[model samples]
Target: MDVKETAAYLNVSVSWLYKNAVQSGLVIYRFGTGVNSKIRFNFSEVEAWVKQQRVMGG
Candidate 1:
């Protein structure tokens, strides 16, 4: 998934994703170099992360 898709999946803003990229469970991968580089996230990883965040309640 790309930045936009990830943001939508998380129900957050693109800017928020970039801001929390380091702390967020989502991992960002970069391809190429310089301005041509692109970022992407593993869909499965993101889903797993989401599952890990689930809370059990009574």
Candidate 2:
């Protein structure tokens, strides 16, 4: 998914994703270089990462 779509999927702001996605462990796919580039996320990988963050209820 693109930045907007990925942000929507995570219920986060686009700027937050740009600032934190990599440092927080999510992967990003970039196509081309420079200001006019496209980025995407592997939907399943993102889902897996989120799942790994799950905590059991008390």
Candidate 3:
């Protein structure tokens, strides 16, 4: 997903993803070069990470 899609999927602000997605190990994929690069996310990986972040058993 793209930044906006990802932000919506994760229910977070786009800026938060820009600031923290990499650090949180979300497996960011960058397209193109420089600061204008477009970023995408792995849906399954993101789901896994979200599961991993759980503090209690479901």
Candidate 4:
């Protein structure tokens, strides 16, 4: 999904998602640097990460 879609799905701002989720490695994906470059995220991975964070009281 696009950044907007991801942000809406997570109920967070786009900037917040980029800073917190992307920068913090809470979600895993690739950053493109060329014409074919794109951002991608796995919903399952994100969900699992969130659950782990909650369990760890983060």
lDDT-superior candidate, 1 or 4:
1
> How large is the C-alpha RMSD of every model relative to the true structure?
1.4, 0.9, 1.8, 3.5
Candidate 1 on 16-57: residue-level lDDT in tens?
A: 988997697678899989988888989998898899989999
Q: Rank candidates by lDDT, best first.
A: 2, 3, 1, 4
Model 3 lDDT tens row, 1-58: 7889989988999999999998988999999999888899988888898889889857
C-alpha positional error of residue 1 in candidate 2 after TM-score superposition, expressed in Å? 0.8
Evaluated at residue 6, the lDDT of candidate 2 is 86
Candidate 2, residues 1-58, lDDT tens digits: the string is 8899889999999999999999989999999999988989999988998898899999
**Regions of model 2 farther than 4 Å from truth:** none
Could you tell me every candidate's TM-score relative to the true structure? 0.83, 0.90, 0.87, 0.62
**Which number leads on lDDT?**
2
In candidate 2 the C-alpha lDDT for residue 5 amounts to 89
lDDT of 3: 0.90
Report every candidate's CA lDDT. Answer: 0.88, 0.92, 0.90, 0.71
Error of 4 at 14 (Å): 0.4
**Weakest ten-residue segment in model 1 by summed lDDT:** 18-27
| Cα distance off (Å), candidate 2, residue 51 | 0.5
Q: Kindly indicate the candidate among 1 and 2 with the higher lDDT.
A: 2
